[model samples]
Target: MSKSLKAICAVAATTLLLGISAANAGKYNLGRKALPEEIKAWNTDVRPDGQGLPKGQGKVSDGETIYNEQCAACHGDFGEGKDRWPVLVGGKDTLKSDDPVKTIGSYWPYTSTIFDYVRRSMPFGNAQSLSANETYALTAYLLYMNEIIDDEKFVLSDKNFTSVRLPNEKNFTKDVRPDTPTQAQQKPCMKNCKTEVKITGRARVLDVTPDAKKE
Candidate 1:
């Protein structure tokens, strides 16, 4: 190549390398370090104990309007899930089924989870679309549809929120295991010490004849 051509190429390469380095330099840095207020702004998660939930009120009746405008397209008009989207109502007795049809009232353990889940991720493609009051109304409507709360009941604001009880609330339990090892599981290893691992058997194939398998 000519001397001029080589010089131009070297300059171009240096400029490209510098641009890449500058673009990625911030990626490796500690990252501007989020301010305390900024952190608080994004971390608006509400706990099951009714902590961090904003001050707002929403009734099932009000929720109906919001649902039809924003949610009915994906989550059926009656909260019945569309084409395997996710059903939000019914399933009162299917928690123990082989293919359990779980809903907020049937499997969820607390009402706060509904608020937290909806606030963080919901409306399918558009997340964080609803405000605190809207989320409250939607949650209340879902509860009403699941038969856990009355349609006229209001669920919002911290005062009334904590009082709301989910249907599957009785399914939860506290972990009572001791910090250290307990007598029930810590027996001294003696006889069948399992010196080495061994593969005993393999599953049998039903109809495959070692060829022409469905991929």
Candidate 2:
């Protein structure tokens, strides 16, 4: 393509992206306001307290089928994870060890997060494809695989989602950081934080594997 043609194409692409941005942002005056349904499509986050959880239920058996067909490609048959994909189960007593295996059963604090994440951004490429029931079923299946729940027929739903808590639930504390921008977690650490300040630096590359006794 000629330079002028390429420039024209680039301008067109930029205009298109800006138009889209303006449409979604709802700030600029050029694009029309987003419809209520359109806004709702993006507002699908479920809170930790099951606030936004949709009414749906699924059994572990159903979850197993879905996992085998839709999830096992990357997360493995038993949530052991394949390649660099995240491991989803086990790691019960390894938190205090040299390497902490943070998985659904091991490190995640809430069951609602399981449901929310699965429904919102799971199954890899085909995100937001799973329904509420499917997500619930997968959550139940993961719970079964993690040995948190033994019954394969156990059903998970929004009604009892808050009741189901992970082993490390008590470990995760609420973020008390200030809402305003102060450049600190809560407040600026100006005084001596440690008894004796020691400058130590660690490499960024850390091979933290998700592994534990499956039996």
Q: Which candidate is the best by TM-score?
A: 2
Give lDDT: candidate 1, residue 215.
40
Best by lDDT: 2
Q: Report the error of model 1 at residue 150, Å.
A: 1.1
Cα lDDT of model 1 by residue, 1-215, tens digit = 99999999999999998977765677564445568999888988989898889888888887888888878888799888899878888788987888788888788888898889888898767888898889989888878888887647555566789888887889878997685666576887779889799987644435445665654
Runs in model 2 deviating more than 4 A are 1-34, 174-215
Give each model a TM-score. 0.64, 0.65
* Residue 185 displacement (Å), model 2: 21
Worst 10 residues of 1 by lDDT: 201-210
lDDT of each: 0.81, 0.85
Q: Residue by residue across 49-73, what tens digits does model 2's lDDT show? A: 8888888999999999999999999
